[model samples]
Target: MQDEPILKVVNLKKQYGPGCQWCSNGHESIFEKNRCLRCGTVYACNDLSFELYPGEILGVVGESGSGKSTMMKCLYFDEEVTSGAAYIGTYDDGETNVFQQSSQQKRHIRNTILGMVYQNPVLGLKMDFSSIGNIAEKMIAAGDRHVERMENRSKELLTHVHIPLARIKDEPKKFSGGMQQRVQIAKALSNQPPILLLDEVTTGLDLSVQASVLDLIKTIQQKFGISMIVVSHDLAVIRMLADRTIVMLDGKIIEQGLTDQILENPQHAYTQQLVYSLI
Candidate 1:
């Protein structure tokens, strides 16, 4: 049906070192209680779970080391999942687990079904490639080979992200930080994936630049009607982009609800502190 969630995750966990006595018994909250006091294992994500509905923006916010990035990495398949399942409803009729898919299948999903914009532009863009080349790379991966069509689509996306068409032939090295980020956004959307994942995309930009990027993201979401999972440490950024928000601490979700509900009446102690601290 039209109401089904686009992405669903259940009991997702990622940890370093094998679980020992400390992980099994000593800590009540593995994420908050980072160290396995006895074994010293790091719990990057502990039973993290949530659902992303179609055409909705779901924000994941928390401090550094809160595992927000880890969760994103796992979903994008950049980091291997230690355990648990994540299902993309539009993938294989929603019956198959994404993490269990073969490497080739994972690559196909990453190229065709998912688009990601990383916090560091370096991670998302090939700095040496021209803006057009960058977007074309994604199209080629999705099986498009006609040069004319690729160039046209690249130009369309570059214009969509507000990058001037005149610089389409220039490499990312020639662009400013915010401009580079815009290029990455265009490339990620070149294939028009059903779901997009953004990891602290506006973190290092100037305040004015941040505002523009945020505006572009909102515009793109409205234009494409795509589902998005946004990870950020900035509540303001999340507030602007998310319909529903989830607050993560250590490695687990501490609170979740509509964006307005969470900001206006935060229930969790950490969430209250985080929300007020921003004020």
Candidate 2:
């Protein structure tokens, strides 16, 4: 069925500070309340679980410090998970938890199964590298050796992301913020990974630039049928890209459903506030 999940996560949590009796005994939402009054531990992310279906865009919406980005970090393996399991359907028949894999296996998963675009171009792209070289770098990490093939693929991806072929030789630092983000997108997709992780890709761009990048993302998803988990504080971005949406508060998912449903009829109080604030 088209609805089958391609990626699954369960009971994911990430915490800062050592666990103490107070941290364990507290009942308040860490995100809403800021910190555990007794233990001083902060829950950057807590008890996150979700499924991303094949060819579907899943949006995660929350305020800053709500652990949305931390969740993405966990999924991308950029940050260590405190405790949880994530499975990619294509990996070992979905039997192995990605968090439990060795560093080498994690690298393979990052290169071959998952692609991520960070909110900051500096975080995702090598600003000093030419656009073509940036994409080629990813290809090289994925075991690509044919220089000509990598170049061709880079050109095609650049065109897809609406960066001109003429600009392919330019370093990202020479481009506009939007253009730099586009280069990042092209680089992420260079290996044709099955799943993509986009973290606030439009955060710092002008409104028009943001729209264009969002459009490019939609087009790419349609063209490649890739599953994606898009993280952002902007409801507009989520509306434009996600079929299903999850509302996270403090480090936990409070509500989730179809994008229209979450926007139109949010059930959780936090979600209602988030939805209404956009009006």
Candidate 3:
């Protein structure tokens, strides 16, 4: 791994409501999990900090309300963060904080620097558009104007993700869950982004399909050397793909280290419960 991080997120926070005196003063005793009992403010993500090294897969494991998805949304710009900064090494030499960028600049970053695959295929793919058309849409968003080139690129990416040539022009709504996820992967890769964010991409799939999707993700990482942050509640999934792991609970990261080390010797109680449950 490179010494310099490909992506760095510092003290990132996302909250749902205005804080009251008890929560605003940094009093943890009055809060219920991540919420202020007195004010009903939900701290969806609290002071999250992490880094993604070049060509490395960073796994973020947490339960349903653990803020993993919230953090992913903040990173992908799907939702605005309440505070904190993220620096992309490829963007402005890692000198600019992406959260502070203008809407146009954020769009540029989303289109060219980062690719996101949501847990829901509906969020990533245009269900009515042809699979190839969906890929082309991302390309066009990134300023690609050549029709033939976009078409070729779309075909190449779709094929790479195992989509049948015959179905390349079919709508994603017609595909199986696995196939839809594959199409979403193809669309995400159309811009050849250096950083990919996967938020529970394999959740709700059959075991065989989940394994196929996981294998494809590993293959993509190997082939493209992309740095990825994969968020999932499944420790088994994390063990298969991640080099390093971060364990989150109630909007905070309680433990993090090498995936193997964390699995073998989890330091936090919650992490231990998670690892032991997988046995």
Choose the strongest candidate by lDDT. 3
TM-score, per-candidate, Cα-based: 0.97, 0.97, 0.99
**Tens-digit lDDT track of model 1 for 1-279:** 257888999999998878786576646655336657566677888888899999999999999998999999999999999999998988988889999999999989999999999999999999999999999998998889999999999999999998899899999999999999999999999988999999999998999999999999999999999999999999999999999999998778999999999999999999999999989
Deviating ranges (above 4 Å) for candidate 2: 29-34
lDDT of 2 by residue, 83-180 (tens): 99998899998889989999999999999899999999998888889999999999999899998999999999999898988889999999999998
How many clashes (backbone atoms < 3 Å, residues ≥3 apart in a chain or on different chains) does model 1 have? 0
How many clashes does each candidate structure show, in the order listed?
0, 0, 0
Q: Tens digit of lDDT per residue, candidate 3, span 1-279?
A: 999999999999999999988898879899889999999999999999999999999999999999999999899899999999999999999999999999999999999999999999999999999999999999999999999999999999989999999999999999999999999998999999999999999999999999999999999999999999999999999999999999999999999999999999999999999999999
What C-alpha lDDT values do all the predictions have?
A: 0.91, 0.90, 0.96
Which regions of candidate 3 fall more than 4 Å away from where they truly are?
A: none
Better of 1 and 3 by TM-score: 3
Model 3's C-alpha root-mean-square deviation from the true structure amounts to: 0.5
Report how far residue 101 has shifted in candidate 1, in Å: 0.5
